[model samples]
Target: MLLHLPEGGRVVHEEHAPITLPKGWFRVIRQREYVPGSVRIVAD
Candidate 1:
């Protein structure tokens, strides 16, 4: 999975050591441009 940021930065989830997501850092999109099950990291 490739995590794309708003600032154009990207985090690639390689086969080894995928990122352990923090709590309350993901957004669930039911509909829209974003794909289902795709997570967008929320900025604090």
Candidate 2:
């Protein structure tokens, strides 16, 4: 899905880009390890 924003508006802001995994979960690249199931919250 994609969303377009024009200028600005009242809203909460967050961003994420992840690589899909075979386990039906995804992971974001970072310097350190990511605890298991952590992505689930972000997915929600």
Candidate 3:
């Protein structure tokens, strides 16, 4: 099942760029400078 935050919001589709989700105006982490394969998920 897919989970959606804020229930509903606006979505902007762009051909030259990625689709932007305006819901809640949450900031997305675009990119980080680091060594390759350093990203990982940890359970709390």
Candidate 4:
């Protein structure tokens, strides 16, 4: 997915520190985790 921070902004989450984004376009990628048998997207 793609995210656009037209005027810049901040992304916040309880388990992570806030991310400051510049005014531009960004590609969104899901965090991945490795398990015993497979790989999966990390839950946020």
Each prediction's number of clashing residue pairs: 0, 0, 0, 0
Every model: Cα RMSD to truth: 12.7, 12.8, 9.4, 1.5
lDDT of 3 by residue, 1-44 (tens): 24355744554545454554544435544444555768544322
Which whole-number lDDT from 0 to 100 does residue 24 have in model 2?
A: 29
Estimate, for each residue in 1-44, the C-alpha lDDT of model 1 and write its tens digit: 33434444333555565454443334544433445777555432
Q: Clashing residue pairs, candidate 3?
A: none
lDDT of each: 0.45, 0.38, 0.48, 0.94
What value does the lDDT take at residue 19 in candidate 3?
52
The estimated TM-scores of all candidates read: 0.21, 0.19, 0.20, 0.71
* Model 4, span 1-44: residue lDDT tens: 99988999999999899999889999999999999999999986
Candidate 2 residue-wise lDDT at 22: 36
lDDT of 4: 0.94
Give the alpha carbon lDDT tens digit for every residue of 1-44 in model 2.
32333432333335655433233223343344457765332332
If ranked by TM-score, best first, what sequence of candidates would result? 4, 1, 3, 2
Best by lDDT: 4
Q: Which ten residues in a row have the lowest lDDT in candidate 4?
A: 13-22
